[model samples]
Target: MNDSREQYTLANGRTSINALPKVSLHDHLDGGLRPATILELADSIGFEVPASDAASLGEWFEDSADSGSLVDYLATFDITVGVMQTTEGLTRVAREFVQDLAADGVVYGEVRWAPEQHVAKGLTLDQTVEAVQQGIEQGIDDARGEGKTLRVGQLVTAMRHADRGLEIAELAVRHRERGVVGFDIAGAELGFPAGNQRAAFDYLAQNFLPVTVHAGEADGLDSIRGALFDGRALRLGHGVRLAEDIRIESSDDENTFVSIGGLAQWVKDREIALELSPSSNLQTGAIAAWGDDLQDHPFDLLYQLGFTVTVNTDNRLMSNTSLSRELSLLSDAFGYDLEDFEVFQLNAANASFLPLDERQDLADTIIAGFQSA
Candidate 1:
């Protein structure tokens, strides 16, 4: 269990909301490695870590990630990926990632990671996926042993900063029958447009594979446009920048009139899920155009405007957060209670890459858990 995932609750005086079932759609597998696990993995490889002990190393990650720039914040991934090169390291880290999520009460999760980053230790791309899958299976059984039931899917991600999109996409499709569920383009989102990976997106479309693109996080609407149009992304990784298209025409105390641009209207009407990570958004300056705090995030506006908004922790270790903590912060910032949190979970359940029947099952599980809560 990740002791860092302390119990959290809504301000409405409910019991531990952390104990309530949740879904994670945009979490990263490589980005959620435990500090102690990294230390152990690095030691076996004779690799040097920034901090000596787990406690200090965890603090170093948290401090380094608060740079308020997505590019700078992503620099911390070097250490996490450094330790995750071998099959054993990948499997162990993935196992612990699921265990941590299960401990935090996540019933369902889709973990995304770029396989290209893990080949340094002579493991083939397919071998890396299999390793992580083995760990996920182990984690599930371990969680069940401790009376905590959880399900996880792998979203094979291609780094947008690199040129292996089509190769990685093919890898994801090859592993679909094994354990993979979806495909994603991650890493630096700006400059590296989804259009750069047109071949990969086209191949995925031909194969009818599900895709979710990292857009509107470090970039603007054009990137999101490419994600939807060029990449045919089923969901936006962090489409908070879609708010840029919303024109607040007039406002008053009682109500406010607004006009959403064609793109914003399209996303809202199409019910595209905005996988918004509140603290990460603020830390990485994804919401800097609005303000510098959670209250300033377009999440509230997007949620109020009827856009499909779902809470997530994009990188639990880098952001030092979990789905539970994200919900607590959102609740505090927006005065949300259990009902609002339930709505977010329902939105995520509907937007999940799971099949119709499985999505319905997840929704049922979420509803039942929230009711029990």
Candidate 2:
């Protein structure tokens, strides 16, 4: 497990970040597996791993992912996805995923993974979804036993570089009533645009299914434009690069003047949440144009500009981070406090795939938790 998973407190030490209610919208299922679990699963499948012990293996994932390239960062998934080709592997990893989220104080989470990737071991798409749903259910029960309440849903993902977009979208709609809450297109964002999956997006639109697109991370504004125009995304995963559209015209001691592009204004006015993962964004070079440090991230700028920004851990093991750690890092970088954190949780809850009533209920729970804390 990541050492960052330890409890984090506000900068002033007034509140415990781990004790605050949070929501995670962009976390990846395969990317959040525990290092110890990876070792066990790899051993059971006779798969070769780079390290023998959990600590070294965890460090290997973090170190390898530190390269400032999205492709290089994504290559670390080969080891994680390699051992998750069977029902046992999928179920166990998923169960532990929720347990970890609960431990991190995430009251609601959406776990996204490409089902097409897990069918390499002969399991059908439906079977893989079923196995994961089973694991999620068990994990919920386990959390309840531990005196925590966690509600999680699956976000079925299609590989953008592959030809299974339509199939994966259909699978997601098929299981909407079971456990799959929404659909997404992830992987290799530079070359493959969401428009490439036009048929799948059309079908999802016709079905009234919510969609979140991975845009503005590896690619630029054109990719994000395609995601908004063609994919009809409800949220933008790691849309940190949308900051590229905002131009600073002039700055003063008291007030700074800037111009927002049409696209940036639209996303802001529409309240489309930008799922911002600080450490992962840094690791993948998503924020390189701005700077190489957390303080340099556009997250504070986006928030100050009235954008719907939600914090997330895109990949826990790879980034060696958790939701609390992400919040803690942001707090330290921007000097945020409890009120700022509460707004972030509220944004995520409102942007979640859950129905309107449930979202309100979640917002209420978050407000109550923060108030009590």
Candidate 3:
């Protein structure tokens, strides 16, 4: 029940994963609320919680998310979202969200959230965005006050199942200078294809907003194709299912032959980063085809094949994980050393939506951080 991440050390005791500077590309805002905060906020709003205490509530989220049912997993958000219906709630949650990421050693993080979902208490979309920005800035200053420095950007997201895609897209573009860095679509990726939000995608594309689609997770190749072709996604969220297009023809003692389809070829060639969340993938059954364990993940395969794969914690509260813990798990399963961890960090840095010069600077930060470690 205690899913809090402990300090993770590599097989070699020389370096600690917790001490590394990392970039988190695909973390969600509503999905990362602290349990104790959730309890207090729910009380303020007179909403009932499933558990009486923070630890019990945290365990409930982790347990329900691991049920391997998207329906059950999504049901947990009803509680978190319930608490975030006010400016105070949103600011507190967003501020604490950054503090949590900074504490986990995240140097830069792009936190995504669907603003439309948080307007149930009569908050306009713009008000919600401002409230969250306020919290983010406060959290950054708070982290610095404690001698930790972190930068955060907002990725305004539209729910794939909702009809306000275009509205959300405009809101994101409006806030481009106010911490919003990118746009995304998340929620039921199966029937609600990215094509359903084509108008929004087209709007963002014409406006030159960077986009990342929640593809190749709940659906297969066609869904991924829609994300790239229609959604114009600069990156793929939880692209673990992109493996469906790859066919392993043969395996021998000395060699293994595999063939890739055109889509996979394009993704690899374009260097579009795959925001892969190993623990969350298993919890949601996203990687069930390969097997039900971390070892069965296609991360190493993708890495070896030269695809831009960056690690992430899709939902820290539900998955009960941190960025350091995710890296540590990958290291344990793949026998990765510090240099390999550096490569992963560098991969995330290069794939981030920062301006080219800034992205390069992030890469340099990772390099310098790793060198010192």
Candidate 4:
């Protein structure tokens, strides 16, 4: 919506990363709404927005989110969730979300959102899921008509601080056959540990549902440990701070020695994916311990250590980013080549919540796209 065509190019002028196939595993449905769409939806619902014009509204979201305070950053979601309280609003936003992903060359995307946050307009949970499914189907059809094939699935989320985890987990399982692919716990990751939702995780585990928890972003190793042990999270949402587990023992001009703590070792040995969002990590202070620059991110260390690291745009609207822009920024910060970019996409494909066969298909798609490029 913000001329992403101009924003998503390789740093070294290698190629247009936007044209490469990608997998989006940690994106947020509520956080990816277009500014114009938000304005229209808010107007129809008589909701107040912080800004009147589309551009100003977009800037407001970025600025609010960039305030470096988690509470301040999360306030931007109030306006988005306010507008997305109806079936019509949810459907339109979901449809455009898919279209935007397709336009950005995302072969597959998992749109995560807290359904509990969207119940203000009195729509039942089932109705909200169905509305989003309808929009996803429409988006797929639209992409097919335009000779672009893209697939999207919903990752139903339960707010971590809320008491609806068990209900939301059941809702995800009930709709798994329709459009839902996975479960996640989001919102205020500091004091709200995943252990509080033990019943939900237990239910999901019994039902064989995959989960990715938002940990290690606003918290530390204890939170990540809870996500793995209590939530049984197959992946970590913005688990960038897991780098804290690694201690740089020594460094030289040629190489640096590091010691991986047990937590980092287990994550690596198990091949659990870290859904690292470059821009959002910076905006949310997830990488504050490392440094205040993109180059300071531990993405390189994690990648070099064979962590199953994957790139994502956690909140495209809030961060004013896309998957392509994320890859581009990583390349600029770390001097990564096309092969490195391909590996990130492949890692994402392998880590997708899709079944094994579909994951294989996604990997093949990424290989073909990269080969062509």
Query: Could you tell me which residue pairs clash in candidate 1?
Result: none
Q: Cα deviation in Å at residue 265, candidate 2? A: 0.2
Cα lDDT tens digits, model 1, 106-144, are 999999999999999799999999999999999999999
Model 2 Cα lDDT, one tens digit per residue, 277-297: 999999999999999999999
Which pairs clash (backbone N, Cα, C closer than 3 Å) in model 4?
A: none
User: Which sections of candidate 4 miss by over 4 Å?
Assistant: 1-4, 11-14, 251-255
Give residue 3's error in model 1 in angstroms: 4.9
Top-TM-score structure, candidate number: 2
lDDT of 3 at 295: 99
| Residues forming the 10-long window of minimal summed lDDT in candidate 3 | 1-10
Is candidate 2 or 3 superior in lDDT?
2
Instruction: Output the lDDT of residue 138, model 3.
Output: 97
> Lowest lDDT 10-mer window, candidate 1?
1-10
The whole-model lDDT of each prediction reads 0.91, 0.95, 0.91, 0.91
Off by over 4 Å in 3: 1-5, 251-254
lDDT of 3: 0.91
| Residue ranges of candidate 2 with Cα displaced over 4 Å | 1-5, 251-255
* Model 4 C-alpha lDDT per residue in residues 289-334, reported as the tens digit of each score: 8888999999999999999999999888999888888888898899
